[model samples]
Target: MLSRKNLEILVAAQKRLYCTFPELPSFEQRWDFETDGVIQALLTRLGDNDPYFHPRYAGHMSGYVCDVAVMSYFLAMQFNPNNHSYDGGRATTKMEVECLDSMARMLDWNHYQGHLTSGGTIGNLEALWIHREMGANTVICSKGAHFTHKRAANILDLKYLEVDVTKDGSLCSIALSGLLAALEATDVPVVVCTLGTTLNGAIDPLDEIFSLKAEHDFKVHVDAAYGGYFYLIRARLAGRNRKAFDFLPAADSIVIDPHKHGLQGFGCGALLLRGVSESTSQAIYTHDSPYTYFDRRGISIGEKTLECSRPGAAAAALWATMQCLPLEEEGEFSRVLLSCHTAAVKMSELLFAVDDVRLIVREPALDIVVFYIECADISAATRQLYEQLKASGFYVAMADCDISSETGVFREVSCIRLTLMKKEHLAMVDELADQIIRLSKCIADEYRSQYQAL
Candidate 1:
């Protein structure tokens, strides 16, 4: 449900907006407008869509974006500025710069250069394209990495190689070392490390991957689209995960999605580069485009990105959200993520007591909880649990995982994936776990009855 108080505030602010500009022209935006009926129909159609803001929808690597982002995005679109050129988005471009710097500080970079992209996919594409431009031939990534790296490699026509992951779902440095050692010495491969994988919230060891750089020459690019904001709560995480985030500043390039955990709406992500200098970037951006980049008003962010004509509204939304919830350790936003981690922890503990449940990692490295039904027909039971949960209005996801760890943990089963990403979901986890057990019991009983009759 939309907040009435915020809507009133937005209306009040909108009234004040007209005072700033000369009132030369105005148009009616009431129900009488020609598109109003169509908009009403669209709203009705949207009711069938899944409600992601609700706590029940813990299906995937997404969460409830904050209200401030909605308000800021709506407010900025009134001007409809384009962030491609300097004069085209004088105000928003600076806001985007500030937003980039804020994210840089979160990553512990005192000085850096970056620009916002449409989302993580394009953000990663630009990084790979830059590597290709720098004479890098092949792309090496873990099996757990996002599919975008391989797809981007195909789009750019570069050779792609996949490495093995540890049983804990992290990129195996040993496998990567062997791959790098065997590669032709003349070729420099771009190694893509993941901070948080989409399948399971597994964090690759960033610190260990960089260690291999000296032994074998390769540029390191981090795919933190799902987990970059976890940097804010680095102290909350421990062991391999915490150590991995600490080494983010050492990465050559990083990709993050503000649309996800950053609490902005969709279509907002960023690409941060460490080694690309100002003069070098200028040489890269200065192409033969006559009329587009002629404006000397300020720095145009489009030069830093592969995408053209980016929405300034996304930048405005991010800038405003940062003001409301600054990306800092031990801050309110970090506490939200901490609550999610705690929720996952609680779910893990509760699942242990359930009759037919096996946690994939015992404890989640992040907020994603994975468990399979330990039954004779495990696959069927897992699918039934997923469908019944959705029907019960407690939407969760399913993952087909084949896991093998260094600790001698091995499982090849269809599993349930619970992404308790909302702060509110923390409170309901106990009940959520109860529902899983109750539903699992029914599934097990039904399977038993069928087997006995047969």
Candidate 2:
């Protein structure tokens, strides 16, 4: 049984968070939309309207709470398994193994193998390390790929090749092929394909890149952290055209975040290597232990995992959430996520109507809809708009896109991105939309008046 004091701490933590919520709502709100929506409705009825966005802070997608995630977090704490060694936590490790298998199967890789990591960055580094060990000297990724890819290359001390992404933020296959040919001439190795880019949610052309791999001898790794799970949700909705869903399992290794789309709390992610074998032994550096060895499989998790002393509580939470909500078509969680995609499209449509702001990418590939303030040399004007909206309680940030000039890379573009989630929040979309339109018009008018006077 759990200790009374520990239980009290949990309760106290909840109360404190609730008390401080309005003042400091972290990207992740503990209360579900339904719970908060009811209070919001009541307040609106009473004419005590208040906007929910926190100024100066962007919300993290991993912070959101579903009922299953909350239950998983607590239940895992109860078991308190230490997934380091077999003796310490056999059952918990087995649970993680099953989860890994499910992740592989979901990606359609029957012979795939993977383990949980703290998050996508760790998973990415681990995958890159394995590929580096397998004779990859040069790593190629989209210019818009997460900074972690370059950081991972730095960690390994390898030469990183960044392919200029197309205007939509996806790597062009021809450009990549030319680079690969140039690298091959120089005897370079390895290509890391991006499944979904972080900034604009663009999916790299996997089929074309894989075709290049078939002709050449370079290992491929896919960073599917943000968009991999979309396959399952999109497949169920789109049915026959599931060809796009099949790209995940094709890479030599892949990174998928259970925290991002799995609806679990943060710090729980997985890195999967296709066809893992004894050659890929995870290093062991520990004092002799009775329960360390496993006879069936030569590789224990510690061999492959980057972390040695991680929280099994995260694994237990994920396991419990999986039990409560399966990833099938009929599951409620997938449906909710599908609804989030719908909400994104809805938001995009509304944003389109506002003048002087155009979508960076015409159509969204996932939940992220990116748009920029399309005015010239007007950082001051845009900054003013951002300040006004933030002061009015609408939280958003000026997104940056690196543009290459003769001088080098510069952050010359400014945009606002909306990551839509929760069906209940969709109901408030129009209200938010109206505010954006109103603010944009006001700012444009101010800009025009000032320009004319000057």
Number of the predicted model whose TM-score against the real structure is largest: 1
| Regions of model 1 farther than 4 Å from truth | 23-33, 403-413
- Candidate 2: segments with Cα more than 4 A from true spot: 1-63, 185-188, 235-244, 282-300, 402-411
Instruction: Estimate the TM-score of every prediction.
Output: 0.94, 0.79
**Model 1 weakest 10-residue run by lDDT:** 403-412
Candidate 2, overall lDDT?
0.68
> What are the RMSD figures for all models against the true structure?
2.6, 9.6
User: Which residue pairs show backbone clashes in model 1?
Assistant: 167-404, 167-405
As a whole number from 0 to 100, the lDDT of residue 216 in candidate 2 is: 78
Error of 1 at 154 (Å): 1.2
